[model samples]
Target: MSGQQHILEFRFLAEPTDVNFGGKVHGGAVLKWIDQAAYACAVAWSGKYCVTAAMGGIQFVAPILIGDFVQVRCRLVHTGTSSMNLIVDVRARDLKAVRDRLATQCVLTFVALDAPDGKPTPVPKWIPESEEDMALARYAEKVMEVHRRIDQEVSDLRPAGQDH
Candidate 1:
């Protein structure tokens, strides 16, 4: 909405189907919304088809109830040669409420692909302008570092000459 292609926001009413047996919106449903929002932001920023590469730091802080207003905000925080990292925040508010409560938050990585060959393709670089943008980019970098460490640990655990 601000002419920034790197950001996307979705707002919708929570449906009864989104509720779990506990009378709140289910975790899986919230994750689906996060993915959808992140995917849209990735595609918008890259101007190409994008696939989710990884998801990390998922935190479900609160539960969304049926009939609440749900909003998912996704913004590009960092970009690699072919991958874009997005910070997705999901919030919910009762219809009569004045403020929204954070329901979930996570970082998602998406990779752009060439249309013909389906290979990873470079996406346009994003430059941070404001302090908030810079901070978010730094947070994304930290998340990537964590992912790298985990991957390395997993690889180290695997038997030599065996790639799984």
Candidate 2:
């Protein structure tokens, strides 16, 4: 664990129960892990409970088979008055290999909430220091715009006062 508390990593085994019909870990299962890891990072950085406002560009490059070791790594890349952006990377390692390979990656936006009423609340500012941190922040910014556009497009597809 880093003393700065900017990043967090969680490891889990891809269980048989998580497998899809094709015999690989379900993409939704991996997404759930991503959300959990990002929430952990947001809660740690904001020191408050958080809600996922949006997710950006989840790219599943490789498959995670059952019995493989799954690692979800999350880091705080950017912050606003009440919104926090996190970059989450998922990797999987076979039983025999020590090194993990990238399986999925995405950026997510979370909103810190006041505990009593679950209202939006401000969070501590996160200033990127390292080059990697800066790059990730920039990437998050770009992805956020794309996410917003996609959300708008989806909303346009839905009728007024109706949920999709």
Candidate 3:
């Protein structure tokens, strides 16, 4: 889903070190980029340190080959008392073919933290100033709904006698 008006762009070149012997970039490498991009976006929005609280809906749609240039784009999707939701999309550009394709997508949850004590901190409310921005906000709401249901289902499945 689309998110806030501001989109943060992060780019990296995939080298042999980032790839497996099969020539595809490792999933762990992509995940690290996603988290870095998401954290940067959250900090840009909140102007504070942010820590990852959770992540969801990680889907790998395409493979990134060695020598591909990878780009991660992130945007704030939702906000709560001290947390912000970010959606990040990872794409790979084939320098040889000059083609760009989506490789992976994920939703990340981050909480603003006080620098002094690493306590929970508040972030500014996401204000959509245009029609398109408002539409993204609506999409974020829908994503949040799905996240809530999934969380509830997981909670319900836990053994009654065990601590979750």
**What TM-score would every model get versus the actual structure?**
0.92, 0.92, 0.84
Task: Report the lDDT tens digits of candidate 1 across residue range 18-51.
Answer: 9999999989999999999999999889988999
Give lDDT per model, in order.
0.91, 0.91, 0.83
Which lDDT tens digits does candidate 3 get at residues 18-101?
887788998998999999999889888888898998777789999998888888999886778788888888999888776799
**The 10-residue segment with the lowest total lDDT in model 3:** 1-10
* Shift in Å, residue 135, candidate 1: 0.7
Count of clashes, each model: 0, 0, 0
Error of 3 at 39 (Å): 0.6
- Give Cα distance to truth, residue 128, candidate 2, Å: 0.5
Query: In model 1, where is the ten-residue run with the lowest total lDDT?
Result: 1-10
Residue pairs with backbone atoms closer than 3 Å in model 1 (clashes): none
Of 1 and 3, the candidate ahead on lDDT is 1
Compose the digit string of candidate 2's lDDT tens values, residues 101-134. 9999999999999989999998888888899889
- For model 1, the local distance difference test gives 0.91
Model 2, position 64, has a per-residue lDDT of 99
